[model samples]
Target: MTIGVALIVGDTLRRRWHTDSPGTRGQEFPLLAAREQAARSTAADSTLASQLTLPEKPSIAVLPFQNMSGDPEQDYFADGIVEEITTALSRFPSLFVIARNSSFTYKGKSVDIKQVGRELGVRYVLEGGIRKAANQVRVTAQLIDAATGVHIWADRFEGELADIFRLQDDMSQRAVGAITPMVEHAEIERMKRKPTHRFDAYDFYLKGLASLNLQGSKDAADEALQMFYRAIDLDSGFASAYGNAAFCFVRRLVNAWMEDPKKEIVEAERLATRAVQYGSDDPVALTSGGFTLARLLGELEIGEQHLHRALELSPSYALAWTHRAWIRVFQGRPDEALPDLNRAMRLNPRDPLMPGYFSVMGMAHFVAGRYEEAASWCEKAIQVQPKFLPPLRTAAASYALAGNLQAAQTMMSSLMQLDPRRRISTLRELYPLQRNRDWELLTEGLRRAGLPD
Candidate 1:
């Protein structure tokens, strides 16, 4: 197929650069425009962050598929379809998609189209509803104006459950075809809007939520709490945000930055349950709910199930994978957990939390007695975040396992400086393994690393 290059003109969508030489559809988008478009679009998105560096390519968020079937049980079927679509869309390496963590933040939210564009920093948004009965499924999807609250294109997909994958491909193709443009108007589509939505205070709350998820330090956590309060003042129905608020508190506890773990865990559970009640199928709510049940309530099986369901609904979801990976690592099958963490990294390579992913990968290898590989991965992790706990510990442990006591001691000293009291005991308590094998593997590593009993 012969393709020509054409530069898209401002205000009107057209070929950006016209050339006698053929260019792929992706190449047709001017590099500068694509970058600007992503920035403009994210500034429009209402997710948990501001202008994000995208994955391989720009990405759009597909929120939870609405359960239009009026049958509660069929909610699973709808969620499954969205999960499939999210997975398919992510396979393309060109778009930077908001991890489900940020995307699902809008689960119960009524948003301004421009705000969606601004917040997610994407050129488009794809959302739809599913109505299913017995074997019949009807799905409707639309690519919308994240800035103008306008629908650029819409399509309805109807078929039997057996043809689910086909429907997903069709939806992705339509969305990709409609939104993949190089240029249009000076504003593209993201316009600075004066939001006049239902909850004025909630707007600030959204801003705060975005800030907290930036995942840096205590300052971010404090900001998240403040935003949750603001959101509650505007709409108490914002139960989902409340769960997010509790999540911040739980982070404090788990990181040993808190005065009381038990008390904070209780509060986290309360908020998580409320979020679930308010919006059941929401991936965010499910994450919070699952953590509370498993980590706080010690309901291991149910917690695993909830976390599993969350991943099933949003395959490109990094946070869910993070939690799930930890669960597997603790269960003694670091081998099983490796893929989950790898998936998280691929979904958001620019994520500042790269250290965590590397750390876990190293630990998984270390526990499996792959000392050389563990040390290698930990070194890569330290390049990202020097003070990152898991990778630091893994480095020391890997060295010791390889019988390099001097090197192990050196790394241990650094780890101790970063965390004054290196507490293997605390890690066990916070992330108590549901499986005996996971517990044994990790603990055995701690012992090998010269962890004091």
Candidate 2:
């Protein structure tokens, strides 16, 4: 029972940044460009061009909470609070949350709002500080209009150290509560939010989440898995960590990065089962666990039930919708999956994982017998992640099915370069698609593209 430092709050601050040059550090981000275009199209008004283009959904960035405890060891606690807040905010489909990695780039630095807003492409920013004294903590936070430097909301929360998790949940929900009223007073949607109760386990989970966001290389994923495993060891009841650990195993298997697929699959199934069993009330845990069960273990019915419950618990959770869409396609119901996929895209238009979303959309289209549209979507996915084998394979199959043999052959060659051992013979074992028709469609396209059957 080691509680290093509880969260402490300081003061409220607000500022705005403006454009100076074409190549300003944060002004020319590609991520922002895409978001701006999406926002403009959604607005459907040329008159609004003079104003700052905001996303269809209110967008925000939660900067790293400052550690005012003076003891640097409490740094982890401060970061953990910010991560939890970010996660809670992301659960809302009507809110566009800048990922933790992008927002954390400003950690410990004096940032201009113009630069931050431009770089992150967020309309609002939340900043805060924490000060801990023994068993009690004080937390102060404020929300700002990035374009106007106006302080829309601010608050202070103080609680005993034993209620650290509750404090974090309150802080996040309160911030969302404040922002929604300020921005969307006409339609303020509320949700039943849940939090992990254990502080020690949560600390490790936060660290693991940060590592998972890296996704830059295999080393990063492995490190994330290690951190998640440590969290599970510290608290075997930490279901979210188990769910994430199972996902890491799925990633390895899909990318052909696993040295022993049989062993990893067994471990993944065990973790997924445990995650669902223990995390019956946790939406994130249910989403990830259900996805792993259906996608990797072929347990479609149980997986769909968990996912359905997750959505019922947190209807605005975009990831759960995305996973449900994925399961639907494998269930030979691609038409039914399209709405969920589109809903996911609208919820987080600037998601860093848009490549995967695009690839899934392509799969939905492919299964609906729309080969050309499928090829187009898969191309976008491959553009975002060239070496992403799933999208690569999807692109090849779509192209071949569309009668573009040359393009299909080119895509297959690229896929083979990434995974030299890939073959149609193992598609069933790898994808675990439940519907026979869906499996046949996938295999037939790949075979037409020259994949060894």
Best by TM-score: 2
Off by over 4 Å in 2: 1-80, 89-125, 129-140, 145-149, 156-163, 176-196
Model 1 scores a C-alpha lDDT of 0.59
Q: In model 1, which runs have C-alpha deviations exceeding 4 angstroms?
A: 1-198, 292-298, 437-441, 447-450
lDDT, each prediction: 0.59, 0.71
Q: How many steric clashes between backbone atoms does each model show?
A: 52, 8
What would the per-residue lDDT of candidate 1 be over residues 372-415, giving only the tens digit for each residue? 89988887766655655667777887887788877777777877
Residue-by-residue lDDT tens digits, candidate 2, 270-302 = 778878988887777899899999988888778
392: Cα error in model 1, Å: 1.9
State every prediction's TM-score relative to the real structure: 0.57, 0.75
